[model samples]
Target: ELHLHTDHLNLTCSTFHDVHMIRWRLAIEEFGPTFHSVPGSSNVVADALSRLPITDEELEENPTVTMAAVEAAMSGEFTVDMRVIAAEQKNDKDIGESEEREIAGVLVLVHPKSKKILVPTRLRLRLVQNYHDLLLHPGAATMVITIGQVFYSRGIEPDERKLTDNYLACLKAKHPATRYGKLPPKSVEVCPWFEIADDLIGPYGRKRFRALTIIDTATRLIEILPATDATSMEAAYLMDRYWFARYPRPTRCIHDGGSEFKREFAELQDNYGVERVATMTRNHQANSVIERVHRVIVEKIRTKSINTQDEWANFLNDTMFAMRASNHSMLKVHRLSWHSDVTCWWALPTKQIGKRSINAR
Candidate 1:
């Protein structure tokens, strides 16, 4: 019996799935040789023969074979025809009379200012996909900048955005560009002060004074009261003096779940028959109405008390006045003006019809 030792495991197997391997096995089996497995290190002669380099004389003698091997290696690669790209650029209205340049023996259109090669309309998407895959799928802005560094195309940014938006792999890996959930239902209030939102602004300035900010959801009227601390007692006292006493008690009072809004402050709401709606933990959007106003108030205080930060409480009245006078984006009227309409109705002692008495105080 003839024994053949080799490193190739597939050659040792008598059963073959491939057509060529089966034919090879049948021809070798006719000789009735026993196949033996050996380690690659032990098969030095076969390994050396497989890795043998061709001589210059042998390559010169077999030019056709060398050309066929090169063609086989490049069969799977994508190649752009510069002539076709140049022809398409002339027809593309968006490209509109761009300068042409000969790059690497190929005529191509180029951006006038940047002097980078301009990709044609037909290949723009394909070019973006290739670069995106090469870069392991980056964000749209990154891909746009990277591609723009070497190559350019008109409306590339939008094209890249569209391509990435539809890519399934990217969709799975990246967070959505827009907010996910549906918008929260809007709270509807028929009368001014029916629903109000309240929040505490600070611990700002050297005095560490905190302010209770209350806003009427219907009229957009804002009321601010400065205090030494943010305790429940102080919050309740400030609200009673500045908010509860000044306006009708809001049916629903929305606020954050701060320590200052518990115990005494909650009891104050119960006493007035006002429903206290505390926002979810760490979720400020539940009380966004008053939260948005916090930014404006802080900005105003910063501007007014630039030198002496301890005097921030002194600017509370001025900040409230400015906010009241400014046009409300949602209401489309001054907050004070909208509130004056309700105040006038309350002023009239009798329900008898009389001359209008709206004042912007």
Candidate 2:
């Protein structure tokens, strides 16, 4: 017969309330050993062995230690000593006569007005790596801006770009900067409302509300109307009530192949003499103008709706005003300003078109 001895006084009890203890008892029972309740003083050898220090060789062979070492190397911990930087700064000719300031108990060179630290040449790479990792590996421009907030280094932009370019994780996650093909030349529209694009934005919030998004391609002016559903009748109603009621009727209306733009929507466009141009299936690029605006509008609504997402409709007008007041990337002018300029330009005498028009060819 086998024998077992443990200092745990509860082990000798027949009844075990703990599931783990019961499982251990069942497992030990398989060996057919007699359990003995031993004095705590008799467990000296096992206790001493548990308290023994791990040797270097044992640590080297440990999988946990090896993994920790790998992690430490990858993380590139901050190891630059202030004394070392202070010593090296004296030799760095580029540092010039910059003022040295003791910040947070560490000696660092600081710019007079900006008060930003001037990092030593040898420490810049490690500093950049730590900042890059801490900020979750932002893009080069973002990294420069973040570093500039607290630290100043000459040619830091190129250094940051170089590091990010070589970083394997960043390489796998980031998109290539190269453009695949030449972008098609922009089409010049002389007047606003000549061509327009429309699309539906949501099914967002608790109400499952959606917004009908319409844009004037020439002026980049947008109109957003909230609806309870994405039905053809609702789309037509919003177009009639919001768009056609305010501005001049558009010649062509570009939209996706969704069923919401069919039936009643097609009939409404037909009656109004507006040609309905359905985008090619699965090709959103056909209506890229409105598609781009949709992203901006959704982002704004999402930001404003935060804890009150169910009331996204309440922020629609604010979103519209912000979009109209903001500068258009392509036109390089505010949407409202562009709309006003286009309207006034067309209002001028036809004789002045060739002489004084802003976009005269």
Candidate 3:
């Protein structure tokens, strides 16, 4: 189907009788620049039409105008209202005949049999109809931007207002307040605040006797919750309240299964729309965020704050600030931008000019 040019490899002086070039469109008296080069397809028509500059008045007068008129409409000047367009669907040679015949146009795909290709400039834009449903929520902001213009349509697309509403809606939909996944991709809540991370950070009686510490995973933003009682429920209550006032209730609270981190502390997640759980077959490295945060506090805050505290208020406050100031690669996912790939952390709205102090050490 290459311009019906069969002898593509035949390089010889052409006999006039062998080359019968047929006229495509008599209206195209002068063949303008070739915007596209799919020689055997209708993409040439689409490309030419896209370069046109028709005004609304002209559009009203020539709704059924020729492609040449479209080229005239978009030449040199630009129009904002007339710019949105959808992706052109190219068909394979072996496609079923039952499908709509797609030429150079906007597509209305009802089904395989119900689709029709309309004019390119007359399409509808929309929300991200491309990302997986699971990733269409608040934390997954990249999903929206990734598919913002996807399969570009010309219809009314979601505006900034709807965009925010969509985000909140997805956030509420996925939060544990509504529903939580209860299996492998998400496991069961084992207890309230009792997540176990065993670290041996003492030289009291012996050289290195370890303290098998169990911490409330949720509220440990403040590091040390009171461990006066052997059972962790009392401590879990204090930690649970702190987080209840902040983040969306966690679904799976994780830690190592130590005696103190065990018991019924995981249920605090349920009361505050969370789920607590412990790791069975591993060490402190399993609940490493807490352990890491702990070591950092023990090393830095113990020296900087210039005090040791069984009461964790001071220790926890500085560590919380440090964690926020620190960069996390998982939290700072990246994607292609107009200029370059930008991490999500950098893209976040900067704190107001005279607001919070940022310590990114």
All candidates: TM-score: 0.43, 0.45, 0.30
Taken over the whole model, the C-alpha lDDT of each candidate is: 0.66, 0.67, 0.34
Clash number for each model? 0, 0, 25
C-alpha RMSD of each candidate structure in angstroms: 28.8, 24.0, 30.3
By the TM-score metric, which is better: model 1 or model 3? Answer: 1
Top-down lDDT ranking: 2, 1, 3
Q: Please, what are the lDDT tens digits per residue for candidate 1 over residues 1-361? A: 4688988899998666895675466545533567899999899998888799989888667643210111111122334556766777777777777788997787778989998987777778777676554433456766676667667877677889998788665654443432221225864434556788888877663345678898887567888877768899998998888888888777899988889999999999999999989985334346767756774554334333222334445457656765665444454445565555655545443212222222323
Mark the regions of model 2 whose C-alpha exceeds 4 Å error after superposition.
1-188, 306-310, 340-343, 346-361
Q: Candidate 2, which ten residues in sequence have the lowest lDDT sum? A: 65-74
Best by TM-score: 2
- Which ten residues in a row are the worst by lDDT in model 1? 65-74
Model 2 lDDT per residue over 1-361, tens place: 4566778889877677995675566445533467798898998876788799989888557624110111112343455566667777887778888887997677767888898887778778877787665444455766676667677888677888998788765554333441121123554545556888899877764456688999887667789888778899999999998999999898999998898999999999999999988975434345667866764554344233222434455466656765665444455445676556645645555343333224432
Ranking by TM-score: 2, 1, 3
Give the C-alpha lDDT of model 3: 0.34
